[model samples]
Target: MELPKVGSIGEYIRQQRQQAKISLRQLAAQAGVSNPYLSQVERGLRKPSAEILNQIAKGLHISAQALYVQAGLIEDREPDSDVLAAIRADVTITERQRQVLIDIYESFRKENRAGNPEAQPTQPAEPPPDAAVHRENTATPDSKEG
Candidate 1:
């Protein structure tokens, strides 16, 4: 797939922030960035780092992977289903929750693929070691969210 122009990332970020009804200053604050820097980034005067993009994604209540795709840090690919897209696009869920849902979805997919050898691998998706910890932790009310 063709990637978006580098300059469009700024526009994407600005658009997401606006859609969230956040002012420039408020978004900057939420992203733990300086207002001037974020303003520069929004206007395409400055390129933001990946870390900044992640923070901006968090502040905008959007997907970091989506932002990464827009920024060309990652290749864009169609999701397997609307359910996956909806999970990524959901604004009400926390990032951790989104990840958990995705993990479960991926596990199901792996189970299906294992049953049928004809299914091709799209990528080498390795679950993080801490994913098990997350599953275990979620079962306990006292577990602190990272």
Candidate 2:
């Protein structure tokens, strides 16, 4: 697999931190690193170790595996399911809560699949072609309403 370009991981980290609305000094304090070190990492002036990456991940409330993949320390795997992505993206939930929900969801999906050997996995069904037309026909303008 092609390796990520230099500073890509730093860019990813910066993006995540911004998305999380965390300050550099706050992150550094949480990750137990110096502010200058974290700044250097973000600027690609320094390459952080895996352990430091893990600490930063914890500080950002994200998975270390995600950072590892971004840093090209690990291979990117299959994309997560919509449900898994939703759970992981929810900032209101704690990391432990997210893991528990994901585990439960996967277990239920596995059980459902196991019960029916020939059943296909569920995907969203497309709306019928005429559905939009029907809605347009039924919808009334303000002037037409009683």
Candidate 3:
């Protein structure tokens, strides 16, 4: 079969989507665009605005610059390094706190293994051996002859 050309931004969206092996309906759902509009765009009958292009780019898991390049808006540029750096910086968690959280999570997992429902009411702790209950008869004790 002859391959379709990647001619415009819309065509690029369709091409990338096909390359990713995602159905047009799935892409439309992910991009929050209607199926008919996506089809029209893919056929080059409609051109989406930059904001919509960004949505398409996000749905395709690609940078907007790549889409712009494919649309003949500008030459291709490398992905933004600052975006990654900012993400790494935003995850400012300390190792100690992370380990503590992991330990607490594992403890809860153990409770789950012991058949505890997540929101069930808990029972009180068992009493100590010395604190065990005992029963006594009300009648007087029998006396034995020595």
Candidate 4:
């Protein structure tokens, strides 16, 4: 059977643990894995198999399916509305700014959902530097003599 590439699974495990606010030693004891081993796994230097992943999932109190998707062991559905809303609501911005930003975001989202790139706004170009632009410039290879 196929296994997820080690690095992705490790990264995902680490992210989930951090988000859950679990300490490495605590989680290691809970998952029945050595702290050093779990640390290596979290750093993407080791790939634990399904049984171990299931243990970790149980310790985290989350579905193994979620970890599987993170590990790239399984395809996942798009996040549901509640999950998406929760994420959107977690922003540090004030509610009024969030609403305004959400309105702009939703407008583009509608265009994307409709498959209409032409409906997108054109971004403004950056301004050119004034005459004060100097070249204390770390000279690039392209600027040097052949």
Q: Evaluated with lDDT, which candidate comes out highest?
A: 2
> Which numbered prediction scores highest in TM-score against the true structure?
2
User: Cα lDDT of model 2 overall?
Assistant: 0.80
TM-score of 4: 0.49
lDDT of 4 by residue, 13-90 (tens): 776677677999988999999999999888877777788898998777656865676666776554554543553334
lDDT of each: 0.79, 0.80, 0.66, 0.71
| Candidate order (lDDT) | 2, 1, 4, 3
Q: Put down candidate 3 lDDT per residue, 42-135, tens digits, no spaces.
A: 9887777777788887787766765665566765332354533233223244323434554575577568778888734468888788996678
**Candidate numbers, best TM-score first, in rank order:** 2, 1, 4, 3
Residues 11-83, model 2: lDDT tens digits? 7788778877899999999999999999988988778899999999999998898789777788645455778
Q: Per-residue lDDT for 75-130 in model 1, tens only?
A: 74654578777876665665568779988988878877787665554678899877
Name model 1 segments beyond 4 Å from true.
1-6, 79-146
Give the TM-score comparing model 3 with the true structure, all chains together. 0.45
The deviation in Å at residue 58 for candidate 3 is 0.8
TM-score of every candidate relative to the true structure: 0.52, 0.59, 0.45, 0.49
* Candidate 3 regions with alpha-carbon error over 4 angstroms: 1-7, 77-146
RMSD for each of the candidates? 14.8, 6.7, 19.2, 13.2
